[model samples]
Target: MQEAEDLFPAPAPAPAPAPAPTPARDHSAAGHRARLRERLLTGGPDALADYELLEFLLFAGSSRADTKPAAKALIARFGSFAAVLEANPLAVQEVKGVGEAGAAALKSVSLAARRMAKGKVKGQPVLASWQALLDYLAIDMANLNRERVRVLYLNTQNRLILDEIVHDGTIDEGAIYPREVIHKALDIGASALLLVHNHPSGSPEPSRADIAITKKIMEAGRNLGITVHDHVIIGADGHVSLRAKGLI
Candidate 1:
């Protein structure tokens, strides 16, 4: 019995007393996120820098991780908070740590902004709210990489009836036909219309082609007794009104 006890070493010395549990990992990141939330609630959005605002937005997509690096990376890539919000979904997803969920969150903000701007002119006389109209158009088209031609169909009282895209691509006479503009106006029974397009070059100056196309549409609308209110060209810098410049 003594030899057996020595060989077994007295039941392995009670499994060496088991090891003590290690403390949990530090939660400094969670603490920082909580502080950010407090500041946002107490100080409002203006209290934060662009990256901080973006970080707050990123939290919706990545709740478990520190989002400062992702926010800073997005701002660095897109140049501004607005630019990031307006960026194409695929382009936005190119940023590191921005997957489908993050892209959706960013796009949701852009859509809300557009709807809010659109509300300022909807069902109202667009000419009366000309500044609001300009703001809405700029938000919709200023940052686009390609040209798009849209027509705002207005009722007899100059209230906006429908805002429709007539052509989407390079803006020229061939792409934007005078007949189509007039026909659409007649179809919608719009008494007046506004021609709008954007310049991808960031300059609001109308080229000779732009002038020629506007005149063609103006003539067609005049023949049809539909008033052409204005041809507005939007750019990243500003917008140009052809009627104000005596081009239409």
Candidate 2:
């Protein structure tokens, strides 16, 4: 019986293996977003770079997505934060990941900026806050791809009455008639007017055509006892006042 038991000895128990180490959690993206938020709260918008500011804006629209790439791409495509905000919604949507919602988000900023600027100039003498008026024009028209002619009608006090777009796409005599401007001024009871247009070429230098048209409009307004305050040309680089240059 002892010999038979020895032949069928129990097998040794299998050795236990050591447990594998758990991988570290990757929180890098979350950590970055937190840091950016902290910096913005502490330092205000001036502390963040353009792309960083754009990233923050994108985060509001897409909380879970990584927004750095989209922000950088927008800035690169549109040239600046202001430009991106002012861009057409369709143009903005051309960028990957910037769908309708993202484009709308950017457009909302532009609309807000315009409203704020208009508030500063409306019901106040535009010349009294010259810088603010210029800023409003820059924000509204500087980045436009086509030429636009706007008329700023003013009351006797030089306070803005009506801001109207007279012509868009091109500013030829056929499109911008002196008679039409005079009729509008009369219709609005504007005692004075400011003629404004944008040059998409980034240069505010007035063409001969621009000078000639301004003279025509000025003459028309003068005959009716309406003051032609200035003919301001907006460009991407900066703005130019025909009055300042003695062109008027």
In angstroms, give how far residue 177 of model 1 lies from its true place: 0.9
TM-score for each prediction? 0.83, 0.85
Compared with the true structure, what per-residue lDDT tens digits does model 1 show for residues 1-248?
57876776654344566678997655787877887788888995587888888887888888788888889999898777877888899998888888888889989988998999999989888999999999999888888778888999999999999999987885433267889889999998999999899997889999888899888988889998999989999998999999999877
Model 1 stretches with alpha carbons more than 4 Å out: 1-27, 170-174
Model 1's alpha-carbon lDDT is: 0.87
- What does candidate 2's lDDT look like per residue over 174-236, in tens digits? 246899999889998999999999988889888888889989998998999888999999999
Candidate number of the best TM-score: 2
For model 1, state the Cα shift of residue 62 in Å. 0.3
Error of 2 at 100 (Å): 1.6
Off by over 4 Å in 2: 1-27, 170-174
> By how many angstroms RMSD does model 1 differ from the true structure?
12.5
Deviation (Å) of 184 in candidate 2: 0.7
